[model samples]
Target: MRTLRASVLARFSARASSTLAFDSTSHLDSLQHTRIQDLRSALFKGGAPSRIWAHYTNILNYFNYDVLPLELHQQVLRQCSPPVRSVRLSDAKRLAQGKRLEHRHLHEGRFQAIISNIRALGCTPSLDDYHFILEHFAAVGYHVGCHQVYQEIIHLGLTPQTKTFGLCLQAIAHRLTLPTFEVFRMRLVSQTRKALDDLMSDMRRFNVPFTTANLDLALRIFKETVDEEGLNKLVKWTYGIDLDNPDCSPLDLLENQTTSSPQPFSTHALNTIIDTLGRFGDISKVVQAFEVLSQPLPQAKQYRFSSFDDEDDFGVPVHVPSPSNHSLPYALPNTTTYSMLLRHISRARHSTLARHYLIQAFKLDRQ
Candidate 1:
């Protein structure tokens, strides 16, 4: 019985020794990972010693985060340096390309650690850095969290003087539904007028041409704020017409009657006016605006026909009896009488009558 007890004790001691060996191996592996992360961090810092990158690459090849403790994993990332310019442009490019290629292998804890460090430092990251983090989050298909990062930047008040804020705004704008527009308006209005003004000024100063779709958005907002008279003034002003100039009406500007070279309003601006008119249900006013657009002025010469065979010839002319001459005892031929009446109506550009004739022709064809 004593021999059996001694044998059992020896077996237990051997198992304990094996467990200790395993633990020691794990601790060494953990230490190596920490060292590797430290090397990677050093490589990112702007003024690190030249030998660091080589060691970083070597350590990166061996370290695996799957088995590491969460705390140690974080420690690894915390030890890393911020990205910096490489010794050579090619080296920098290589680093970028490598990151692009291997970014998928990046651990989430490491990223969180880096971000926490960035926040703690209270330094606004470069646009590239922000975009990198954004892309990282996006690649994981986690848009909600990505938006939170943008919100964080705004909350921290680190978004000033950065195009990243504009990019974030644009992204949110694109994703915004009608239901979200109110929220967008509230948030945008909450920004300081200086910030808003700076954004607008940058847009103009950079000559950054906005798309028609984006301009439509601006027009929608503008329409919501301005009354009819104010809107009309805006339209005229956009065409370089001064409303305060008693000599120039909106029509005069449309006609390019000003002394300066005629600078017509853009098609987008014109469309905005047309849309505004339609939204107000001013169909007749819209037609009047079209007429004003169609009319030939000094700036826009009317085309005249020199000869029937000329390419520029408009069409053949038709003669019509005067309205006073319609009282004839001798009845005119039915076709000729109707043709003369139609010619007179056409000369007057009677669109209602023209449509009536078109409908009658269609009915006659059906018959």
Candidate 2:
């Protein structure tokens, strides 16, 4: 009886699939107009939303249905307004599986379909939606996909938050192609720099606030892509650290800006910027960045530091949390920071200075 039941269920599933296929084909062949109302009603009549979406995409391709277009996919979403939670979850799962399977193109095709569906529903995609799409493209080095999502956010009049902006910078960075020939390298680098400039201009237009994350990502992008001019521009903006101007110093910016509002710096951003400057053998700028990094973060939340003074655990060895855990404004130099400084000194052939930094690093660790 159990074997018979299983057989019957399998037959029923196959029959249902065949019946739906036949109906979809007939509808497509019979109608030149292919009204969206009918399309939506037909596609969603049987299966779950995700299944329906996947099936319909395959059906459209199978029939070579040009009349339907991408907009039809959107129309189904707008008319039905199927809960996107499951669809998005499924998308993430597929992407993860695709990565393991080495099928990036297939993953992107599905993602494009998902985006079309989101747009079709006449619903403004949230920051999370945009971020997910951007990440998919960014991970695969699909720079065009990243730009499309960025444009869609702007079209919806949504300002990308700092994290989103950082992702955008990273996506642009991935477009960079390093060439062995100097001529090709120059051309490629120039184009990338222009693209980056345009992205920054868009950020300004959208009123996206420049934060430590943004600055750090931008600096890393420039460093990786070998865009010295871009790096210089970033340094000047973040800390007024310009190599061409020997007189320029962090102290000058801090003291002069006391009369104005000084921009708050993050230790991570300072570390990355200093590390990059050090790579270029700019000892003075590296030192300046360290000075800034070591200073107390004036803009940090005061309540966080206030807890440090509380006497609730008097004589008890107080457990101090790292910057990430405690919400402190600045972080002390970790091992990586000292390593960068040592590398900088060594690269400049200053064995004496490198040894000095190495010893300092060890002492700090012991303390």
Candidate 3:
């Protein structure tokens, strides 16, 4: 039965093009003279006629990404009711599965048909369905499909959960070539701000569990807006409040001060901050943050090192020359220690200091 259904679906798709061509020529004169009233009258008189399945098949035939007139396309949507729309969508999905259809071609057809159907339904598709389509299109790198999905979400008055919103944002962020970034920044900024405000209000009013992931997304968008100072201020405010009152902040409950390793931030958040800092050439701030993060706690004295050979090598021991004190013993330098420091310094572009260590590395290599 499934195979039979699949075969019928394929046949319908094959015939769709010819039907579309015939409709385009025969309807061209009427379509050119058609008013919105005529279209509305056709839709309300008996939306989704028995002939709709055939009409849909014909419409699909004429649908080319490059050439379809938007008005005539919308008129076809007006002819379908919800049930017919659903049927058409199912047919589109089945047609998309054909091996001969390229990803781009399939995506364009499916996207246009799905969007038109959504318009006919007078409501948005469920979030799960929207996500499935968005992910499918995004994987194929169909930017137009992705944009349509985003616009549909907005048009449908659906506000996705933080995780879902974050995933969408990250997907766009990952694919942000320079041109795409510029376009996204211009097109999405206002919509994004409204969405962010809605999300923030939800978090504040409902006692919704705002995870680090949520904060990370907010941070990323802020970075995109080129508001580093604003981001830093927001972070300081939020973290300070959380630290001062653990009872009020879910994030505080997750903090682990006893662990020596760094806590993981969301990769999206970290990447955004790193990219922002790099763009501004604030290398010193990066180094300073690393230095502070690397510091040992007072209770961690047992983990701190006094000698380069010490197993707990958290702190380095180095001597500075003094004008009056001359009785200090000549310390035997650890070549391994010097070599490691040289590697770090070189990577950080402190070439002069690195060169001194490089000289010692050569001696150790000789030994």
Task: Point to the candidate with the largest TM-score.
Answer: 2
Q: Rank the candidates by TM-score, best first.
A: 2, 3, 1
List the candidate 3 regions with Cα displacement exceeding 4 Å: 1-106, 140-148, 177-279, 296-349, 352-367
User: In model 1, which runs have C-alpha deviations exceeding 4 angstroms?
Assistant: 1-116, 119-123, 129-176, 180-213, 220-269, 280-289, 292-297, 300-367
lDDT tens digits, residue span 265-364, model 2? 4556656766777766677667655655555444333345636444445655566643322111334777778877777878888888778778888898
Q: What range of 10 consecutive residues in model 3 has the weakest lDDT sum?
A: 322-331
Model 1 residue 37 distance off true place after TM-score fit, in angstroms: 6.7
lDDT score of residue 40 within candidate 3: 45
TM-score of 1: 0.33
Q: Per-candidate RMSD vs. true structure?
A: 20.6, 17.0, 19.8
Q: List the residue pairs that clash in candidate 3.
A: 17-61
lDDT of each: 0.44, 0.60, 0.47
Task: Please write out the lDDT profile of model 1 over residues 242-331, one tens digit for every residue.
Answer: 323322344554555533332344544544554555455544554444334323223212333344553334565644322221110111
What does the lDDT read for residue 120 in candidate 3? 62
Candidate 3 lDDT (Cα, 0 to 1) = 0.47
Cα lDDT tens digits, model 3, 89-146, are 5445755675322323243454457466555645445666666555555443344445
Q: Looking at candidate 1, what is the lDDT of residue 304?
A: 36
